[model samples]
Target: MTAVTKRFGQFTAVDNLSLDVPEGQIIGFLGPNGAGKSTSLRMGLGIMEPDSGSVELFGRAPNVQSLRRVGFLPEERGLYKKMTARDTISHFARLKGLSASDARARADELLEATELGEFSRSRISKLSKGMAQKVQILSTLAHRPDFLILDEPFSGLDPVNQQALENLIRAEHDRGATILFSTHVMEHAERLCDRIVMMARGRKVLDGTLKEAFASLGQGARISVEHGFDLAAALSPKGFEAIRTADVGHGETWRIELPPGREAQDALRAALEAGAPITGFAPEEARLRDVFVSLVGEADAAALEASLAEDGVA
Candidate 1:
């Protein structure tokens, strides 16, 4: 989509956002809640129309022909409580143009891959939350679409299930499918994305490869020390702001903020001079959460998270 804009009354939900999903690449659409990630995705998938600009899928405007080759998992989780897991998946596959036999076979294969084969005959209402999530994801992939768009695929999942989902995404990517997913959790994107597109307040704030994004943030390091360490005293005199600090058993760890052109080791040397008994020290790569704070401001980032928790919009 290029220069796509969506509005609700006087509020601009998505402000002239432009994005491209390259074939066979896993792109992480990252942002806090209400940052327009969902809105941008809806426009691209033809679920909602943009008041202006254009959206294209596979070289032309998004339409039925293009949609057949696409698989989508929306943010909200929903499945028919009366339907069996296998039947639910097969139903969606049939909608995507699969024959009865093919859909059933594909659904079985997917259920097995996700380790939910035992629940294949279980009604949706009888499954646990994680089990239901896996089933929903299987339903999305039953047709084997060439392109996949997942909005917050990890939300509400336990660690084990989240890891399982990540493996599934990796397998799909290895099959040469193009994947685009959105998420508030930084760890997922940090591990899976080949490229990242960051949004804030309905605008694209950053877009690049992981390495490029880190390099652009200058330099920094996470510092940990043994007991009797004073992180604030060590860096404050040198004009370095410890962006974050945490007490760790009789000691403290600091996330030092580095000015442009400064190396992470510089902070180490400063710690040494300050007589801190260093337990661990290394260069810190900028995390996506840090990038969010830098781009969107601390207050807004915190507010977004709070809203997500209270409203359950993950």
Candidate 2:
């Protein structure tokens, strides 16, 4: 998509958003709810027309031939209630242009791969919510498309099922399928994505490799010293800004904010040379949540945390 925009009445859901998904890469589309991720994805797949700009799939407008090479799992999931799991997968695969025999074989393969083999003959209404969702996901990929687009694929799954889906995504990538998945949860993106694109309030906020995102925040560390010791005051003279964060059992923990181009070791060296009785020390690592907070401020980050809490993903 290039500068694609979409609107719902007075609300502009996606605004001048341009995104590129390179082949053979697993890209994570990350943002809290109402961040325009779903709208952008819909536009990309030509499910909804953009108000401005343009969208191209497989180098042209989405059509029958191009769409057949792509697999999409929408945020809203549904399966045929009376159909067996195996039949459901086979049905979708056949729609994607697979022969009847090949579709049934693919269904069996996917059922066993996801450990849903025993449930393959069971009706969708007889399966649990998670199992049904998994069946829908498998249906999307049963035809082995060259590209996969998944919107909030992990939203309704438990931890174990989430892990299984992650592994399934990796396997698809290993099979040479390009994948792009959207999620509000940071941990999944942190573990699985090669690059991340973040959105907030219908605008793209950040887009880059994980290392580049971390480097944008510079460096910092956590330091602990003897109780009642003023580490902040002691480190101030050496050009390091330290804030008292918490009091441990026998010490006070301080967060040292290093200036740009400074290293964490410099802070440790300065503290040791200043005769501070240190008890614990650890370099602060940048998290995706921290990056989001830095980009959109605390309020939006808190909203994201609330979304995660509602979904039971800490």
Candidate 3:
């Protein structure tokens, strides 16, 4: 995107943010609730217009053909309450240019894939949220579009269904479909995403591999030695932010956040020098959750409001 901007009057939903999702890759469009994820997606899908900036969906203009070639599961879970899962999915597939027969066939295939085969004839209104969510996923993939966009796909599923959806996503990525999905569950993203794009107030905040994003955050590498671990004088001399100093039943841990340009080797030496039995020394590379919180957590504060004012200029 180049200078992408949008507003609901004075309330800017999206800012001049830029992003990229290459073919055959799954980009984790990640953010918290009301962080402009839905708004940006609506713009990307041409469901809404940007007040200023460009959005190119698949090298072509965002139009009917572009939308048809892309399958999307919106965040809002609204199904035809009276319609059976089978009819609902097939109907959407047919609308997306599938032949009636093809749509019916795909409905069965995805229903079974998502473990909703037994509920195919069940009306959406009669199914539980998890069941309805499965149907929504089936609808999104039934058309076999060139690209897939899933908005909070794991909202109302049990562990089993969540795994089913994840496997299906990996399968689609292996099949070479451009995939972009928004999610807040960090562990799933750590395992699934090739790259992650974090957003706040509709603007792209962080974009890179999970490791890269972590490295770019407040700390470099985190080191947690064994129980009774104390390098206070050793570590304090080197400027490590001691997050805590206590034994939490399970194990005595000292959560330390290293500063930028500062390597963990310094801490390693201190631990060794202090005779703190080295149990674990690894890149506590800030997790996706940590990086996200570090970058976007303060968006609700006055500091963020001022930052947004400067960033909103496009």
TM-score of each predicted structure versus truth: 0.81, 0.87, 0.79
Q: Local error of candidate 2 at 96, Å?
A: 1.2
lDDT (Cα, tens digit) per residue for candidate 2, span 1-314: 99988989999999999999999999999999989999999899888999999999989998889999999999999899999999999999999999999999999999998999999999999999999999999999999999999999999998899999999999999999999999999888899989999998899999998877776675699999999889988999999999999999999999999886677889999999989899999998778988888889777888888888888877
Show where candidate 1 strays beyond 4 Å.
221-281, 307-314
lDDT of 3 by residue, 198-304 (tens): 88777788889876786787764445556555655457766776654556454455666767666667667766776765555665545676777677556533343
Error of 2 at 206 (Å): 0.7
- For candidate 3, give the lDDT: 0.78
Error of 3 at 262 (Å): 8.3
For candidate 1, write residues 35-63 as lDDT tens digits.
89888989998889999989999999888
Candidate 3: clashing residue pairs, number: 0
- When sorted by TM-score, best at the front, the candidate numbers are 2, 1, 3
- Cα lDDT listed for each candidate: 0.86, 0.92, 0.78
Candidate 1's TM-score? 0.81
